[model samples]
Target: MSSNSNSNSGRRRPALLVLDLINEIVHPDGKYAADGYFAQARDRSVLERTAEAIARARAADIPVIYVVVGFSADYTEWPAGSPVFEKARADGRLKLGTWATQVHDALAPEPGEPVVAKHRISPFHGTNLELLLRTREIDTLLLTGVSTELVVLTTAQAGHDLDFRVQVLEDATLAGDAEIHAAALKVLSRIATVTTVEGALPSTG
Candidate 1:
């Protein structure tokens, strides 16, 4: 799918949002790896594509904001009735300050980059993501992450509702399987610009 050109006259200020690429979610040894996320990521080379996107954003002087999902050791932030986080709570995974919650090394944030910790699917829900974007005058969001049907889709919708131009880097995201990933991208195309890392960034040449 291709992105529509920006209609606004002013230049668009953009930021790259790397969401839930943490070890517990995307890494091969992650808690959810057995469920097929790792396999899909490996086949798609999601990490490599996302790393390229991050590098492009940095070279273009665009901000790169990292969003990670995790909760306190006591699991207080977790939703008791939510099936999405039930496994995490039961297995005691995704606790803050743990390696499972850290961003994968391949696409790890630079020292001064902003890493926003979230407890829910949508990063903007209880996090300062909006504030950070507003402070930086970023009017566009380039999204890349794991679980295409979950975090990527949710964030795209939320970003659209918040009046930001949202673009999903399809190659940089993974899901349970190829079909699931394609379906999520189809849905996301309705509300966001579904594109590749190369399409989202400028050419280095």
Candidate 2:
């Protein structure tokens, strides 16, 4: 079905799901910089593109929702033996209330925009994301954020399985490596409509 299509009926209630584009992962001095993911995000100008996407979505009256990843100060929510989050807990990154956990300044959420904090890569895991979407009646999601191979890929598939119309904004997401980004996009195209920021927006002309 088209991104604007709803599961129960042919109605469109679209929203933008901005995932994990926080300082803890996207900035040059982020705690995960040593992992080399931030470098790729910067090179790809993910923040700039995401900023543009937010602007376009807002202009089109689309709900803009941010999904941020952070942990309790005591690291209580850090899942045990999880490869994706083990290093973060060990290195003390993504501490709540820290500057590193804030969304990238370029794409800071405006007033009234919902910011969903999640502990896992998938925004829906252990979070109220589904509830929020259901409340807003949003069934079509425009997914954007860092590490296309992980969060973006996972969320796209999950969103599809959940009966939501999903679309991945190519220019607005970043990955650890160019090859990985390309491969994820290729795979995601099968489950979701992969488009650039401009293409994802409704035509003003």
Candidate 3:
């Protein structure tokens, strides 16, 4: 982990946690592209905004951690009855080692940056995310990613419950619709600090 002078004992060391910015959820050719959610997100340029935030985090020497969702080719780990994973399994998307599961080219994880694969919505669930955070002494998470009503919201709430100071980068996340996105941000404001990408950046001045 790179050191940042802005982070001291008085404040928790911050890391940027990007959730589910995978090709399957972001790219137009992805399996879920038929649903048009990814198309809308791309149209709004959420990926570009996320990339900008990532660049700022890197410049500040803050840890950039990626949380992606994927399943095995057989998808045996995916529960049959679960509404979420079941549909994903049926669609045959997010297969491990496939382009769909891979993070988008626009915001790829550089060498040595931790890329954590998650089986569920929360980054902490069934992943080494908590260990990575604790190991790096990261207590403040700058959350950014797709599906504001799903992964971003769930991860922010989970991070808060785990006693980490969480902030959701509003422009860095996208939902299926504007109302859902706005609503998620409003509810998340109660549990986490809701801010823009620039707001999460370290002050260079």
Candidate 4:
């Protein structure tokens, strides 16, 4: 966890970033469930915790941004030689217009919440996420998502570089296994505040 006193200070303008909670990655019936993300997510109660985080953000009047990874029907934006996304291309998963790319129902975005689509691990890459944050004056980020080693970590590093204070809600995220999740959180602790939803956003009195 980051020791900086201001890491979770209440005064900082914050936005909740829900990353890759789409069906293809975390849903039980999704194509990528065979990779163990679904099991880990279920075992860790990631969806439940993430729901709580989202609700808290909403109650606190914080902007909530959803980032989903998907490709067009023809996949013109798909990265051709990348190891991470190769399986997705091969399996024809993560199609933008399909159920596979939709956000999980448990944590669905409300009527007007922005759902930004990206073709890469980092939400900031080739997406208007940064512009949204800048326009909203969001200087802090509360991250909650699936596959801790991938999107969560990538976004934390990129957000830090972009000078936004980043906090990863540990209980609201997981990897393919406990060890991988822990290791990723350990690495993220140095650059971002690794905290639980409660720790980052206490309930109102």
Candidate 5:
């Protein structure tokens, strides 16, 4: 279906989902960073692009939501010895008061935008992201963030399953696995609209 067709079919309000673009945490740099085909040096440009997208979304008056990873005082939610997280814990990473847990200041949401704490790949998985979006009467979600194949793709899949009108800003999302990112784009295009950051703009009134 066309983008408008999918959106207008049932969507009520527009919102933005900004995944974990916080700090330098990513699949390409931690315990999972060098695993198999995911191995690649983190791309600085991708992070900058995501920052740019966030700025644009805010300018458009689209409600923005941010997701970040942080652990409780005792790290209860983190599975003991899980390779993806254990290494970080051992290295003293993403602790509640640490720098890695903070959203990069350049792209931080404003006073009223919601911030969801996450423990896994999908921010919507263990967080109240869905409830916040619903409370805002938002039916359309524009996804923007780092590592497209991981957080972006996972959250997008979850959003699709939840029956939200999904639109991924192609330039706004990135990934360590080029193939995985490409595959995600193709599959998501089948289910949601894909547009460039420049293509989506603040509506002049």
Candidate 6:
């Protein structure tokens, strides 16, 4: 828990981190994806809703940050012998300077918006995200992104450990599988505020 105590502490608005909205689609085989379902698993609806959430956060004067996964062309920066590195080595996806590394058009960040590149499941692990958040004096976070069981879960755990108030936008994130998505949300709902996109909209105040 945060030691912060002040009348305005709880009311300070939360920043928004839209995670992994990049074009790097994973597990296209569907066999390796969640629930083994193809149609909804590949749909971009969740990304779109996350984009709307970012917009709302911006309108509320909250900072909006994006975290994406991408590696240098040769991926020499990936930890030696990592499974993700091995998979990318074979697939050759998310190469920097390639179209696949670009954030999706519908949810791309505008000029001057920060897009932090990460190689691990937790965006803040080796990135400047935590420093940036601290510099901005943000005490809460409105988390939304893909792979609820992966990136989203790792981030929430980190946020809780760092003493930031975290809220997982239920309808604004998706996993590769429906069951995986549901289970992740259930686990996260206990440790953080779990809310629907509409219910968590920025207040007009």
Better model by TM-score: candidate 3 vs candidate 6? 3
Question: Model 3 has how many clashing residue pairs?
Answer: 0
Which is superior by TM-score, 1 or 5?
Answer: 1
Q: In candidate 1, which residue pairs clash?
A: none
User: What are the candidates' C-alpha RMSDs?
Assistant: 3.3, 2.4, 3.5, 3.3, 4.6, 3.3
Best first by lDDT, ranked: 4, 1, 2, 3, 6, 5
Cα lDDT tens digits for candidate 6, 1-205: 2536413565765788888766665334322233332234357467557767877877877788888877788887666677644666576766766776666676778888888988777899889999888888888888887778888899999998898888999878887677788999999987789986666775565
Best by TM-score: 1
Which of 4 and 6 is the better model by lDDT? 4
Off by over 4 Å in 1: 1-9
Work out how many backbone clashes candidate 1 has. Answer: 0
Regions more than 4 Å wrong, model 5: 1-12, 26-44, 81-83, 202-205
| Pairs of residues clashing in candidate 2 | none
TM-scores, one per candidate: 0.95, 0.93, 0.92, 0.94, 0.78, 0.86
lDDT of 3: 0.84
lDDT of predicted model 1: 0.90
Q: What lDDT does each candidate get? A: 0.90, 0.87, 0.84, 0.91, 0.69, 0.74
C-alpha displacement of 54 in model 1, angstroms? 0.5
Looking at model 6, the pairs that clash are: 34-177
Candidate 1 displacement at residue 114 in angstroms: 0.4
> Ten-residue segment with the worst summed lDDT in candidate 3?
1-10
lDDT (tens digit, per residue) of candidate 1 on 82-110 = 88888988889999889999999999889
Per-residue CA lDDT of candidate 2, range 1-205, in tens? 3343564465667899899888888888888877777888778887788888899889989999998998999999988889888887777889878998899888999999999999988899989998898888888889899889999999998899888889999999888889989999999999999998888885575
Which segments of model 3 are wrong by more than 4 Å? 1-8, 202-205
Q: Which residues of candidate 6, in runs, are more than 4 Å off? A: 5-10, 26-38, 41-44, 202-205
